[model samples]
Every structure is written in structure tokens, then in C-alpha cells.
Target chain A: MKKKVLLILLLLPLLSGCWDELYFKDLQIVTLVGIGGEKGDVTVHYSFPSVSGGNGVEYLTAKASGSSFSDARNNMNLKTGKVLDISQLQVLLLSDKSAEANIFDYLDSLYRTPRNRLSSHVALVKGELDAYMGNGKNENSGKTQDTPEFLTQLMDTIKEYSLSTDYNVQDMGSIMFAQGQDLALPLLKMSEESGQPELDGTALFNDFTYTGKSLDITESKMLNILQHNTGKFLRDTYIFEVQGREVPVTYEFIRSRKNWDIGETSITIRETIHVEIDEYSVTPVIGKGEFAELEKKLSAAIENDMQKTVESMQEAKSDAIGIGRRVRAFHHNLWEKGDWHDTFSELDIQVKVKVKVERTGILD
Target chain B: MKPVMAPVQMFLLLFLVQTGTFFINFPSLMIKAAGRDSWWLFFILGLLHFPHLWLFERFYRDFKWTKFISLLYGIYWFFAMVSITSYTVYTLNVYAFPKTPTVVVILLITLVLLSASTSKTSTSVNLGVLMLPLIGVFLIFLMMSINNLEWTNLFPVGHMTSKDLFRGFFAAQLPFGGMELYLLFRYLTAGKIGNAKLMIYSGIWLVFFMFMLILSLAFFSLKEFTMISEPIIYLLKSQEVTFAERLDLIFIYIWLAWSIISLCGIAFAIMRLMNIHRVKKPNYVAAFLCIPYIPLVWYTATKTGTELNGRILTYGHMVFAFILPLIVILFNRYKGRKEPAK
Candidate 1:
């Protein structure tokens, strides 16, 4: 009896292993998920890598519609043999039309689900998502292929260049729920020339609803710089008339800093950018005085463009730059007294820009 | 044989018991009560525990080891054991194994507790050594999360009213009831010193509590903190490393070691009360007493039961941890005056 008890005790550790453990091979790993359509009648798209004997890995897409996001996922699960696992999900795409109406209603499912990755990249899709998903050709090679790996690589390249904000689900959720702040997601559309998906600026959002306004690539880079989200690299081109010639000057951002001063009646935003001149179209022997002149013109031009962007954001009643959050942090009395959304629209604001050229790419 | 413990071992045991499972939901609860000023509320509550610990120490020294005092200590440990076991089981069921039956989880946890309880006090004290490295890893994780910290989230510090601060302090003080176990196990320690050791113990706990509160406030915005059920676990989840993903899983497993140590401490107190040392198979008696706790824990792990359990814990801590010890000290003083000196 003693030996029998010892044997059972010794075997208990092995029995303590997970009884309902799931294996990788038995799971249909969803890489990309897309949500579209109306609130009650929602459309969900799931894309996964399917393995076939001696045929290499094939990318498969499935669609399901139901009354809600979870119901839609459940409907999709009915069509697949394996369990749909979203732990490996890489990106979530939302259609522009549905996003403009109300994106939070679709995102509530992601926030509530414990298994969903909070860091999954979220983007806004322009045009019909069906057409974008159906395209099966590589833009550069003209090969018939539609895979998540390719899509992820494309967005990563865009992120590397600082054309779009690296807005993940957690970031979007934080901004949506947080007061005095809004969210911005990278926008993607099929390129007219290549018929492949490409980064199309950024989609601005007020609270949970998408504003019907977006910033172009230049404006987007400027906003990213002001928000201190200049990812790995940033490139900006300026066409300036240097000595009666339209000289195209390209600058590479090295670093930047933004400071805000909030007062009772007005706000001041100061941005200082340090850049290296990578390309200068003018072939003149530019001296120190000429370089200073070029620097002044560049700062003024950037200041004007940023001022216009801020005006547009204010016109849309979107505090995408988080000035309201700044006010709430420092100027509490103002935040408590007035409606920030309304205050943000008509509040006096100033923009100050200072540009410093660190190095001129092995040339004067 | 009576098991002996060093001062360091006693301190570590008390620290683990006081910090168990409470740190999981503390940030969320604190934020709900005090908003952005949760860190201040935590600081005040930590300071408040010093007097309570001092009073309890005084009571323990004056009373020595009486049957009546042991009975009260046993009741306190009994409630603590059930609460901690139920909380640990609930956490495991929700986060680690969603599909596992609650009964199986409870039984497994109880088995681990029994094994640790039947061992010598020195063996449990050696297990307490694991807490040193656990604290080291927790601090390292906190430092690594500095990239996500937003200093502005801690602004507007004096926004909460006195009433709100009082409520937050009371809510924060619920977990410190674990310190009451010190009264039961004071005999195991080598020295019968003054309140110096109590001060040191309270100091260590206060520093740890303040660190957790401040880090949580700095890492998450007020609105974001309120949305999360367990801010510490979520904070761990946000930390991404190149070598491993899901650091939260690793954190939960390590935290389980501390939970088990706390459970062992509580079970040991109960065993002492029942005079299990008199029996040949004391481990059997300890295991039997823990069986009825499993179903009780299961019942209290539900939503409504958890709320009711919190209310019971609040009032119970006030009575058994504070009021009872103060009354006993006063009664002993009165008796000393009436009986005169020898």
C-alpha cells in the first residue's frame, strides 16, 4: 500500500499538465482580420496559411457575416475544420465607410476578447475591401500571389519610411477611451498605377468616429514629427526658388522636439527639427551665408504647412495633436469650465518652427 | 518539535502573505476610488498600517500563548486561508486555465498547500528564500517598462476630496490583514524584541506598495487604468522582449510561488491552533481541515460571492487585526494595575 501510494504521488506531476491543451497543428492561425459593413450586420474576413501535401503553403481567405463581430467569427469558425486562433493575428483592417460611421462598435470585440493581441497593427482600408483582398498579383514581379507575409512586409516598409503612424489596437483603444485625445490610423488603398495596395496618407479620427479628412504624405510626416512618432527614418522634399531657380532640396530628419505652452486664452506650440541635407538640386558653390538663407526659407515653408494642417484639424474639431490632453494636464480650470471640443475649434493658437541643418551630405 | 524561524524568514513570510494576489487588482481598485491620486492614497494607507502592526505586536507580547488568544488567531487564519485560496484558484481559472474545472484547480492547490504545510518550518522558510529573487525580477520588469511610462498621467495630484481619499485608503488597507498572521507565529521567532522589527516589516511593505502604485499610475492613463481589471498583469503583457513573448505568463508562474508560500503560512497557523503536533500523522489532520475549504472557496469565487467576501474581509480586518488587539492590550493593562507587582 505504501509503494502504491508513492507511485501515485510520483505520477501526479505528469497528470497536472494541461488537460485541454491546444496544439499548433490543430489550429487555423489567422494572420489578417478585416471588419466591415454596418453595426448589426457586420462582415468579417479571415486570411490564413493553408498547408497542402507537396504543394507548398497556400494563402486562403474566408468571409462570414452575422449580427455582431463575435457572431461573425463564430460563423466563420463553422466553415473551417480547425479552430480559428487569432493569437498570431498580425493586422486588422477596417473599411473607410464603416470606420467613418463608427469604428468603436467594431473594435469593442477586440478590446473585450482576452486572446486577441493588443499590439496588432490596425489600419483603415480605402475603397472596397473585397477587391483589395481578391488581387493576387505581386506589384513588382507580376506574379500571382496574395499572402499575409507580403501584406505585412508592405506595411512594415511604409512604417519604416515614416509615411504612416504605427497605430496598434492598444494605442487606438487608449485614445478612444481617453478624454481630450483622438486617434489616427494608417490608410491603405490600391495604387492606380500598380494595382497593389499602397499607403494612402492617414485617417484622422475624432473620439471613436473617423473624420472625413486625411493628411497627405508630407503633412502626415509633419504630424508624425510634431507628435514625436518619427519612426526609423523621415524624408521631406522642399521646392524652393534659390537664386531665381526652383531648386528641389531633400532633407533627412535626424531628430525633433515639440513643446506646448497652454494659457487661459491662447496656446503656443514650438517645434524644432534637426535634419541633414541628403539631396540639393542646385549645383552652386553654396557658402555659409547661402546655407543660412536656405535654412530660413525651409523653416518658414514648414511653419506655413504645419499651420495649415493645424487649422484643418481644428476645423474638423479633431484634437489629433493632443492639445486638449495637454490642457487637461496643466490647465485643469479651463478643462473643467468649457467644452474642450468646442474650445479647441475656436481657441487662439500659434505655431513656431526652428530648423537646424546638422550636416550637408558630404557637400557644402 | 517546535519549529524555529529567524527574523529574516519571518519578515519574508509576512511580506509574501501581505502582497499575495492583492497586487493584481490593486491599481484598478485604487484608480476607481481615487482617480489619478491613487499613488497618494497608497502612501497614506501604507503609513496607517504602522500603528496597527505596533498595536498587534504589543498584544502578542503581553498575552503570550493562551488558549483563548490562539482560538481568535485560528479564526483569523481560517478566514485568510479561505480568501487567499479562493483568490488564487479564481486567478488560475480565469487567466491560466479557462477550461479547467474549478474543483480540480482547488484540489490541486490544496494538495500543494498540504505538502508545504506538513514540512518543517525551516523547509518553508527556505522556500521563502525564493521571494528574494522574485522581488528582483519584479523590479527589473518595472525598470524595463520605463519606455511606456507617461509622466503627465500623474498630474493634477490634489484632485481628490478628503472623503474620496479616506475611502481609497480603506480599500487599500484590506490586504494588510495578512500581517495578522505575525501574531500567531511570533513564538517561532528567536527574539522577543520590541516594535523595532514590526517597523522594519511595515517599512519594507510600504516601499513595495508605493512602488507598485506609482509605477501603475505612471504606466497607464487614468481612463485606461480604469478599463483594465488587473493593471499589473496588463502592464506585464505590454512589455515585449526579443527572446520571449508574453512575459505575463512568466510573471504569473513566478507569482504562483509567492501565493503558495502565503497559503503554507496560513495553513501552518491553523495547524498550530489545532495542536496537530500531538498527532502521529499531523499532515493527515492538516489535509482534512483543508478539504471543507475547497467547496467554500468555490462558492465565494463567484461574482456576488467575491463582493460579499470583500465586505467580510474589510470588517473582519478591522475587528480581528486592529480592534481586537487594541482591546486585548487595554484589558491586559487593566489587569496588571489591579493585580499589583510580584
Candidate 2:
């Protein structure tokens, strides 16, 4: 009798057929999700692949407008036969218009759901969502490649080139709630030349809202270097006037380091970059003294650019460089005295840059 | 009547028990209380466990008062066992199996506890031996997560004020409460001197605690650490390895195994205190002891239940694990001196 009972208990799990189990075939895997519109009436775009057996995967896009994100998601469920599974969601796109207002309100659903992928890449779209999604389709083929996959690959390639920092949902959450740091997301725009979406630069955030200001690609690279987020190589080309002629030199970053010194009334940020000469339009037989002068000019230009970036960020009240975090960590009293955002805007901040030409590309 | 463990087994058992459910959310709780100084608070409170170990060891050496001390320990074990089991069940429900009914999870855990507790003590020690590899896997996962660590997160070490440090110490003491199981199982190390074994075990515990605390603090910023419910699991989530994805799910299964071993240890302690080991049907007695815990476990797995559990652990550990042990040692010493004169 006991043996029989044990057998029955063993078979019970199989008999249940996993009532709570979620099967892949029964789930609509959302690859990309876009949030737009204003606070009360938000529009969400879910881009997924419509797979039919024996046929090629076709990209399908859906839209739902509701009072809240969850409501919009539920409304989307009414339009689909399978449950919307965001566990495999790859990219989250927030339109620039909605992002300028407040993104945290729309992102609450993702944050509250335990199963949502926190590692999903988050990007800021520069223009209308409809236009970007529409242009995302191939013109002649009449079939669209997956938007999220395309965007993800584009961002990955850009990240390898050290163009912008890869900000994910988890990083966004951390920066959003973090006291001393603001958020920075990759800015995506439709390329006028190719009519394809391309990473333009970085979108800055103050608190939970976009600051309506962004850094250009060069300034973005400089900011990344100061934040110690540079990839294997960062290419920078600068123009300097030497001997009454415009000299263009390109430097590939070999390595970089940054240090911060916090004081009572001021903060000093020092950056050092080691570069190998990739291209130099100047004469190869330039003297050593001339090279030193070139290096000084390059350092000053980089410092001036970084100083402007920091000043712009301060004007926007965005501390994406985490100067406030450093102050909170090392200067707790100053952090506790008043609002960090206010103090950061008015504080004496200094930027110093040093460039070392480690290799001259066999030109000596 | 005889010691069941060699000195080494005693150490392993103590280590396993103390580490129960600590890998779950202890770091978050500490960060919530003391901010960036949570790791320092963890170190300070972990050192405080040594005196409590000494008191328990001193109290256990007097065989004349063994029964009374065993009774107090048994009662303490009952609460400690409930807390540990409930925490494991709550975490499993929250993280792994949210849809499964609370009763079913509790019953399944209780069934495992019954089978393990009814068996000989060596069975559980062998289970502890199996845990060595699991612990190694956990440490490896923690090591892999170092690439994502921001070491500056642990700065401004003494930023927490005295009151905040005090609160953090109390919160950190909850995980160390499981170390008190050593008193209940002291018979296992009967022939061994207490000091060396105690120091070795406490030292090992201290090392593991420091490793986990430092890793957690470095893995997330103070604000992020405070906001997260389980910083260690989230830390593992941040670790994207080539071989395995979603390491947190895999790590939780290993954690569940460790929790089972810990639960079995607690169950056996309860059985020993109840004289279930001497019964003809010890398995039945073990099962019976688990009955009252089912509803209690169900309660603790709820939202309000966890809050009450935290409060109980904060105050209860200080009294039962710390203060009460000190009082018992002092009283035993006085009684021992007076009895000889009488």
C-alpha cells in the first residue's frame, strides 16, 4: 500500500501538466518596447517577431494607448492571442518628447515586475516614434528586420568604437534613484544619409527627466574618458595651427586614467590619456620640441572641451560624471549640508588633462 | 550521551548553520540601516559573536546543569529553527516559486527535515560535507562578480553615526544568531577543548562574513544597495558569464540545498531537546514537531509576517543569543563555586 501511494505521489506532478508553467510557443516575445506621449495618456509600442512555421520571421509592431503603462500592456494583450512575455525584451526606447517630461513614471511597470529583464538596453529616440519605427522597415523588401536586434547590434558596434556608454535598465534604475548621480543614455536618431537609425550621441538626465541637452560625439568620448568608461580604443582627431598652417592629427587611445580630489569648496578632476599616433598630417621630420608643443596644444584643447562639457552638465543640473557621488563618499559633511544638485551647480569645479604620446607609429 | 561529531565536523556544521539565508538579504538590511558603513558594521558585530560563543562553551562544560541549559537551548532552537525555515521558504516563494502554495512549500521542507532529523547525526554531517562544493560554487560566483564592482562604493567608512551603527549592528546580528546552535550540539565535541575549536570556527565565520559583506558593498552603490531586496542575488544577476546565463537562478538552487542542510541541523537539535532521539519512532516525533511550525511558517512567509520576523530577530537575538547566554554563564560559575563549599 505504501509503495502504491509513493507511486501515485510521483505521478501527480506529471498529471498536473505544470498548470502554472509558461511555454515559449504560447508567449509573444517582445524584443523592443517604446514609451511615448505625456503622463496621463501614454502610448506604448511593442515590436515583436511574428513567427509562422516554414515561413521567414516577419516583424510585427503593435501600439496601445492607455492611462498607465500596465493598462497599455493589458490592452495590448487584448490585441494578441498569446501572453506578452517581456523576459526576453532586448531594448527599451523612450521618445525624446516623453523623455523630456519624466521617464520614471513610464518605467515603473518594468521596475515593479520581477520577471522583466533589467539588462535590457535603454536608448533615447531623437524624433517621432512612428517615423523611426516606420523608417525601420526595409523599403524594397516590404519586410522589416527586428528593430530591437538592429538597434542592439548598432549600439554594440558603437560601444566597441568607444562612441557612447551602454546604459541598461539596471544602470538606469541605479542612476535614477542614486542621490549623487544622474542618468545618461545613448541617443538614437534616424540617419539622414542612409535613412537608418544611428547612434548620434548621449542624452543627459537630471533627476528622472531629460535635461533637453545632449553631448556631441566628441564631447561624449571626452566625458566617457573622464568617467573611466573608455573601451579598448578611442579615436580623436584635433586640428591645431602650427607655423601658420592647419595641422590635423589623429590619436588612438591606448589607455586612460582619471582621479578626483575633493575639497571643502572645490573639486579637482584630473585625466591622463596615453595615445598612439594613428594619423598626422604634419611633417614627419618635426623636431622633438615641436612634438612637445603639439602635445601641449592637444592637452589644452581636450581640457577646454571637457571643461565645457562639465559646465553644460552643471547648467543642466545633471551630475552624470558622479562628482556628487564622490563628494558624498569623501565629503559627507558637504553632501549633508544642502542639496547636492544646488551645490554642484555653484561649486568650484576644475578639469585638468595630460596627454602622453606613447608611440609615434615608427615615424620617430 | 556521547559526542556525535569530530572537531572538524563540528566546525563544518557550525559554519553551515550560521551561513543559512545570510546570502539572501542580510547585506541589504545592513545597508538600509547604516548606509556605506554596513561592511564595517558587519565586521564589528561578527567579532561580538566570540564572547557569546565563550559564554555558551563555559556554560556547557558544567555537566550538572546540562538538562536545564539544554531546555533553554531547545526553546531557543525552536524559535531559531522557525525563523530560518520561514526565511528560506519566504525567499524561495519570492524568488523561485511564487505560484506554489505556501503550505505545499512548507510541507515539502518539513518532510525533508523529518527524514534528515530521524536519521543518525552522521547523515547530516555527511550532508554538510556535500555543501563544501556548493559553498565553493557560491564563492566562485561572488569572485566572478568582482569585475562589476565599484570599489568606491565602500568609501566614507565611518560615515554612520553612533545610533545608526547601533541599529546596523542589531540588524547584522540576525544572521549570526544561527551560530548559537553550537551550544545545542556541544556534546558532539565533548573530548575536544573548547577554545581552539571555538576560535577556528569563529575565525572561519568571520572570514566568510567579511568576504560577503565587502563583495556586496563593492558590487552596488550605497543607494542601489539600499533599494535592492537581495543584493547578493542581484549581484549575481549583474555577472554575465559566457557559460551560464541567469546565474542567480542557478545559485538559488544551490542556496536551497544549503538551506535544507541548515534546516535539518535545526530539526535535529529540536529532536535532541525533545528526547525524540530516545523514542521508538523518532521519525514520527520529528514529524510531530514540524506540525506546529507549518502554520507559523505560513504566517512568516506573508508580507506582515516578514516584518514581524525581522523585529523578532533584531530584539530576540540580542536577548536570547547574547544577553541570556552571558547571564547563564555567570550564574553557572557562581553556582559551581558555592556547590563545592556546601
Candidate 3:
């Protein structure tokens, strides 16, 4: 009995909890963080939901500028009156100007801090970040939608359509450190009509720096498909010449089989995609001969677009499709000869796409 | 009276000891040494344990307790326990309890060691059975990273050179350090655990380690292995479930529990060694010996402490835990002391 009492006395102090236990009332849960500017001067913006003075939940955005990324974060903390905790951070945005330099410089704090969230969605902004993160006098003064949550959902939608990938903060670290593969992030621009951030294009990155090049929505979709980085659902729309008039045909991706053949100085990529026709402008009373002709035309069109996407990536000196990974794995001599980006730019690449329409959406 | 153990209890005890808290940084160390070939290199190195276990099983019956060997091992266990507990505190400070004082953390661990040391031997041995459910949860959490694995990261096999292979072997000392405890603790078991059962237990452990090795290799790039000191913890940190965002916070506690259980087992072994030496109040002596660990653990919480711990795990584990035991077993065999004690 005495020993039991002593043991209880010994362990009681440990149960009182440590000093780092964050209280809900004292912590300001920062959900979104945006970084912009160059090496010497850095700007950081923080957005979090605040419930103050008996008002309803409202998101407040705070901005600060300093000489470094950590300096800017510490400066932003002075404006928020409470302890800044990013354990629940959901979205991270980087301006194109900042991404033009090495993005790793801005992301070092997120990687080093143990409490920081690694699953936060990462994107690159095309214009000034203040416009998207909302200045005090901008069009976002009366908006009901949360900018960070809305941008996250918009990126998710783009991923489902096979126009972008799901690159989180942790995923970026692996890709950045990989010798053979580069990273591509979704590019966002403020919409002129609605004054909201929208997915404008895809930002191509060579090594850690933004390549100062981007792809439009159609080309981004083609690049995503070539990389086989599709999400749950992929949709593609193409203009077809039917009955001497240009008609639109849309296909939903079902499944695909991809093969990459690497040679000494050239690479061959072949893919067979099975898709279901989601929308066809013409009625489906066509015979097998017309269906085969439609498949051939669709295949040729997609193959041409895929070739263009590859050329654009090569021109930007970006190996986002991970072709260099295969070369490094199989062709050791080639990988050891020179820098992978330079070699990737000079390589001869070919794309052959075959499209098979599996279903016509419950139509004859 | 001498303490006794059942075969399954012995198995669990050995498992806890061999695994312990060392696995936190084992995968990262191997990856740093062997580059992308860490997964298979670890497999080959893990296979070497079979022969080591075979030798131990063959020569264990002839084992005799000498004052010199006992003193050497007692000192070794004390230092190793301190090193491992210090690492656990350091990792907790980095990942989970940053605000907790080093003395406070070490005090908590010391309390556990004190209680386990002073308790009945069966209590410490039975601690492993309680860990079954938590082990299941750990494996489940580990498998959650499967969706994020990039299979191509494991390519370009056999990329490391001979020097890298040597460095990898040295880096494996901590993970493969505890095998010699089998010979030390074999006498405690009431029933004989045959060679086949030992091999089967090690095989199960090998498979578990391989799963972690392969997952870590596929989850992070080769270059990332150099940056992360503990890839397993960082791997868990990157994972997110619906219920919790930071899985590392919870898993670190579980890891702490495992470390405490392993420490209890070592303390029990120390007590047994004391009993064989005809020391009075052996359990109390063992409990008293753990008092110094409070300060030692505090010292090891610093950056230089980790480097010092690494050196101990390398040269100390090689000489005391491995080579000396082999030499003793060979010497006993040469003297024809192969008969089992009645």
C-alpha cells in the first residue's frame, strides 16, 4: 500500500501536461499562407478565421514584409495578437515572381518546423499575391466564400479534370530532391469578371526554379495525361469536323495503358486510352465504319496535342513526365554523361496515342 | 529463487529488445549509407543475423557467468539504455513535446525504470503481451502511406559502391545490436526454445523491418534520406488521417511506450546478472543503478550527445555486444564445455 501510494505520487506530476499544449482560445489557427518577393526582401500573408466582438466567423488576412521568409513570418505574428499556429494550414500560395527563384528557400520553414502541416495544397500565383490574397480595399471586402477553401476546391476540380496534379508540401520536397523528375504546380490568376482566383494554367518548373513558362488549360490536360497523373475522373473536349461543320465532342477517361521505350538518343511513348463519350453533337445512328473513323480522328488529334505538349516541356527544359528517371535507372552511361535537363532538351521524343470509345453514355 | 519465463514471453521480450527505439533512425541511416540500394542491402545484412543466432543457440548451453564478462555487459547495458532513452527524449523534444523539460522527460523515464526494476521479474516479461494491440495499430498506421508511394524511387539498384556497403554495415549496429541478449537471457526460460523457433521469430521481425524499409525507400527520394535524420518519424509526420492531422504526435507516444518496455527488459537482465553474482538485494541494486541515467540522458539530449551516441552504438556494439560474445562462445566450445547444465 505504501509503495502504491509512492508510485502515484511520483507519476502525478507527469500527468499535468507539458507547456506546449495549445488552447483553442489562445491559438489563432492560420489556414492559409502566401509568400511572394525575391531573396533579399520577402513578403508573407496569413489568413485565418476570427470570431471577435460577438460577430460571426470572419476570415482576416494579415501581411508583413521582411528580409527573409522566417523574418516575414515572425513579423506577421506581431499583427495577429495571438500565438500563430499552422498545424492546420490548408493552402500555401507562392507568387510567380517568388517561384521564379528557388521555391525551396520559401519552403524551408515548413519543412523544418515539426508542427507545420505537410499536406497543405501548394500553388503558384501568376500575378501580384495581394490581388489574390485580397488587399484591404479590393473586391474581396464583402465576399462570403473563404478564399483559401475556395482555391483548394478549385484546384481539386482541376485535378479531377486531369489538368493538374495533387502536389502537397511534402510531395514537393521529394520531387525537388529527385534528380530525374521536376515539379509542375497549378497556376492561379485573379478573374477579371468575378474578381476571384481561378486556375489559369500550369506552371512548369525546371529543377527548383519556375521556368518562366506555362501551358494553357488544353495543353495542361494533355501533359497530365502523358504523365499518367490523372485523378478520379478525367474529361476532355475536342472540336471535330462532322458533316462539313465543326462540332464539339467530349470524352470521359475510363482507363489507359502506357508504355515508354527508351533508346540511345530518342524515346517512344505509346498509350491506349479507353474513354466513354460524354457528349456527342451528332446523333448515334452511325455504323461501325463511322465509329472507327471517329476513333482514328480522335486518336490523331490527341496524339498531335500530346506531341505539342512534349515539345513545350522540352523547350522549357522541364522533365515533368519523369522520362529522366527511366533513363537514369536503365541507361546509366547516359545519365552520368551530363546534366539531365540539358540532355532532356536534346532528346528525340515521339508520342502515339490510341483512343477507344468504350461507351456512348447509354445511347445507341 | 531464480526467475523463470515461458517461451512466448521470451519471444516477445526478445522482440521488444531487438526492435526497441532504435528503428526510429535505422532506415534513414541505412539509406544515407547505401543510397537507393538501402532496401536490398538491409535485407542481405538482416539475413546475416540468422547465422549469428545459430551460433548463439549452439553455444548458449555452455555459457558460464564470469565476473569480468558480467561486469562488461552490465556496463554496456547501462550505457546503451542511457543512449536509447536519451534519443527518445531528443526525438520527443523535436517532434512532440518541445516544451517539456529534459529533466522532466528523463525523470519520467527514470520512474518507469525504477518501478520495472523493483517489481517482480514476471511483470517486466509480461509487458510485451500488452504491446500486441499497439503493435497492430502501429502497422496499420504504417500501411497508410502506401497510397503515396512512388515505386520508381527504388530503381537503379546496386548503385552504391563497396565503401558504401561497409558504411551501411556500420550504420546497422544499433538496429542489429540486441541479438546477443538471447544468450544472456536464455537461462531464464523454463522451456527450451528450439533453433527453428528462434529462426521463425527472427524471420517475422525481418519481414516487419523490410516492410518499413521498402515503404520508406518508396516514400522519399534518395536525396531526402540525407536530409532527414529519422525518416520513419518524418514518414509518419507526412501522413494524415480523417481523425487526426498530425499522426506523429500519437505515434511518438507509442514509440515511447515501446522504449520503456525495452528498458524494463534490460533492467531485468541486469538484475539477473546481479543475482548470479551473489549480490544481496539485486533488484534494488538494479533500481539504484538507473538513478545515474537521469543526468546521462540529459547530457545526451544535445547535438553532440547524438554524435557521441552514434559512436557508442558503432564501436561499443561491435566489440562488446558482438565480437566478444563470439570469442567467448568459441573459447568455451574449444574447451569442450558443450554439455547443457542440469
Best by DockQ: 3
Error of 2 at A231 (Å): 2.2
Ranked candidates (lDDT, high to low): 3, 2, 1
Residue A181 error, candidate 1, Å: 1.3
Isolated chain B TM-score per model = 0.90, 0.90, 0.95
Candidate 2 lDDT over B1-342, as tens digits, reads 466777787777777887877657887888888888888778876786777677676665543225566667666677777777787888778767778777777887876777688788788866789989888988987898665666767887876789997788777876776666666577656465568777777888888878877887776767666457788887777666667646777888899889889877777677766662355565676667677888888787765677677778667767766676567667767777311211
TM-score attained by model 2: 0.92
DockQ of each: 0.52, 0.45, 0.75
Residue B128, candidate 2: alpha-carbon lDDT: 89
Give lDDT tens digits, candidate 3, residues B192-280: 66878878987988887888778888889888887788788898899877888789889888999998999888888888888778899
Mark the regions of model 1 whose C-alpha exceeds 4 Å error after superposition: A1-13, A52-55, A134-144, A281-286, B1-3, B55-59, B63-65, B161-163, B192-200, B275-282, B337-342
User: CA shift at B104, candidate 1, in angstroms?
Assistant: 1.7
Report per-prediction Cα RMSD to one decimal: 3.1, 3.1, 2.0
Q: How far out, in Å, is residue B72 in model 1?
A: 2.6
User: lDDT score, residue B119, model 2?
Assistant: 80
- Misplaced by over 4 Å in model 2 are A1-11, A14-20, A52-55, A134-137, A241-247, A281-290, A361-364, B63-72, B157-162, B194-196, B275-280, B337-342
Question: Residues A1-364, candidate 1, lDDT per residue (tens digit)?
Answer: 9958965985685586776587998899988888889899999888888776775676677888998888998898888898788877788889998887778788777876555677777888898776555336566776445646666877787678888777677677777866777788888887877676788888888888889788777878877887777788999888998778888888899997888888888888898889888888674426747788877887998898788778877887888777877788779987886878788888888889998988888876
Candidate 1 chain B: worst-modelled 10 consecutive residues by lDDT = B333-342
Candidate 3 share of real interface contacts: 0.74
The alpha-carbon deviation from the true structure for residue A272 of candidate 1, after best TM-score superposition, in angstroms, is 2.0
